[model samples]
Target: MNFDLQGRVAVVTGGASGIGLAVSRAAADQDMAVAVLDNNAQAVEAATAELQDRGFKCLGLVVDVTESESVARAVADVEASLGSIDALVACAGISQNTPVVDMSDEEWDRLVAVNQRGVFTVAREIGRRMVARGSGAMVVIGSTDTIGGHINHAAYAATKHAVAGFVQSAAIEWGRAGVRINVVAPGAVDTPLLRTKFDDETAQRVLLYNVPMGRLSRPAEQANASLFLLSDAASYVTGTTLCVDGGLTTGFFYNDQVH
Candidate 1:
């Protein structure tokens, strides 16, 4: 699949590291001018510098996705610097593990703000630009936990569910205007975030038992899916959630065999 994204402009939130970083690199590799929006100012600069060193046209901005003002400013900056935004990969998110009953209001709010509101903020802002130009694509990063119920992930799961709703509604409203909205739900990916899930032994065992692939995903693998969704290759695909999980949500297994 020749995903020729050359000459395109992409804005990726949380593009400093992990899956977001990988997506930025992938887009740049395809000859797209990328603007990475991230909260971590230092990391964002470093990531941008690394990409530039590799001869990719890239820029980095510090923006808190949860804040509308920040998001708006970041989008405006990217547009001013990189021309019209051709694609948006909303990868800004946070996760926490807490029993539903014990989850604090602050924690819940933070998760929802970053995961759900962040997606809306970036997508809405970028979507407006795309609508004006009459062309654009958006690829949101959701999680398989949204499908497979997991323990102590109420906030995260709820936010991911909201992401699906956002994508669907946006697709319906914007498809006529040539803006495509989609999502990529990854299973277990070996990123800094996943590492915070548990200790080495428990995390390894859990991933092994749940994922038929017997390992966590690489950031590049997840980025590949996002790139495809944002590229012309998926021009016909919209209002959908594509699972990049390693068969984790496909079916249940009993003694390593599907029932």
Candidate 2:
């Protein structure tokens, strides 16, 4: 099946690095006019320039997803300068791994602010525009941790679960209006963010033991999933979380004895 996104305009949050950057590049590769929104001004400028050097129609804007006003301004800027936003990929988020009992109010609040609330802010603003235009698609980057609880990740998991709910509810409400909302729940991807979680040896062992694929997922893999969800190829898909977790959520176990 063809996954053509030619002439489309896509806005990706947290697009300066990690999964967001990868998705931005993928969208550009598909000939879509792309914009990268990040809180880091330098990074956003650099990334946007790099993509432009590579012959992609791109723009960069500094945005703090946690603030509704900031999000609205950024979306407005993109719409005014970059043409109508055909797709929005809410890839901006943060993660924390504090145990539930040890988690502080601040930690929980920060995670919710950046992850769940950020998602809400971006989706709401973009969804409003999409509804006004009567057509659009949104892909939210979530986590597989939301499926089966992970140790020391209560705050992160909670936000991801909320994302799922938001996607479903939004989809139900907006589907008939020619809009689609979906979530891409990634497993342990080998991005800079994941690298910060553990030492090399420990990270490898964890992936080998837990991930059925026996390795961390690549950023490109997740980007591909996002691209599909955002493209017309997935026109009929909405309100669903596509788990691109390398079989992590499918259930795997360790056996004491070797076969």
Candidate 3:
């Protein structure tokens, strides 16, 4: 399906790598002018260079989403360089696997800052413009943990839950303003983030065991979902969390080979 996104401008937070990078590339592939925002300056340079080499209009900026002033500056820069933002994909986030009892105050606060506040900061910064302009689309990267419970993911899951709630509220408030907001909840995506959380064996024994697809999702797969949500095809879609998991949240898949 044509995304009807050509010549538009898109800003992707955490677009330097992983699913965010994939989304940035996909948006550029659809002929959208892309702005990549990330905290890691080196990764931002590399990603932007790669996209430019591929003949896509791309800009990379070092942005700390946790800081509202930093986000404001980045947003202003994106607008100044690329034009009015037509789309935003809030994919900047971090993950940790410490159990709640064993989690430290620093760890919890850090998770909340990056995962929770980062999403809110970027969305709000861009959302205000979208609301004023009366046209925009946004997709936040959520997780299966947003809906289901997970062990050793207390803080991460909490932040994702908060994101889900924020999307719902934003959708309600922004719907009349022609600004759409939604989320893509991925399960066991094959990104660096996932690899750090589970090794090959542990992934199979712990995470993949519950997946009916019996495989992990690719970063592009998640990006595809985000792209759709950001496209005109999803103009009527907002304030929803679309799960891109490979049936990981459907239920436990017992491989007993029942005949």
Best by lDDT: 3
Location of the lowest summed lDDT over 10 successive residues in candidate 2? 250-259
Q: Give the alpha carbon lDDT tens digit for every residue of 39-122 in model 2.
A: 999989899999999999998999999999999998889988889999999999988756689989999999999999999999
- In model 3, what is the error at residue 230, expressed in angstroms? 0.5
**Per model, how many backbone clashes are there?**
0, 0, 0
Q: Which parts of model 1 are misplaced by more than 4 Å?
A: 196-200, 253-259
Q: For each candidate, what is the lDDT? A: 0.88, 0.88, 0.91
Error of 2 at 41 (Å): 1.6
Q: How many pairs of residues in model 2 come into backbone collision?
A: 0
Off by over 4 Å in 3: 196-199, 252-259
Which 10-residue window in model 1 sums to the lowest lDDT?
250-259
Task: Name the regions of candidate 2 deviating beyond 4 angstroms.
Answer: 252-259
Candidate 3, run of 10 with poorest lDDT: 250-259
lDDT tens digits, residues 110-190, model 1?
999999999998898888889988999999999986555667788998999889988999999999899999989998788
Candidate 3, residue 23: how far the Cα is off, in Å: 0.6
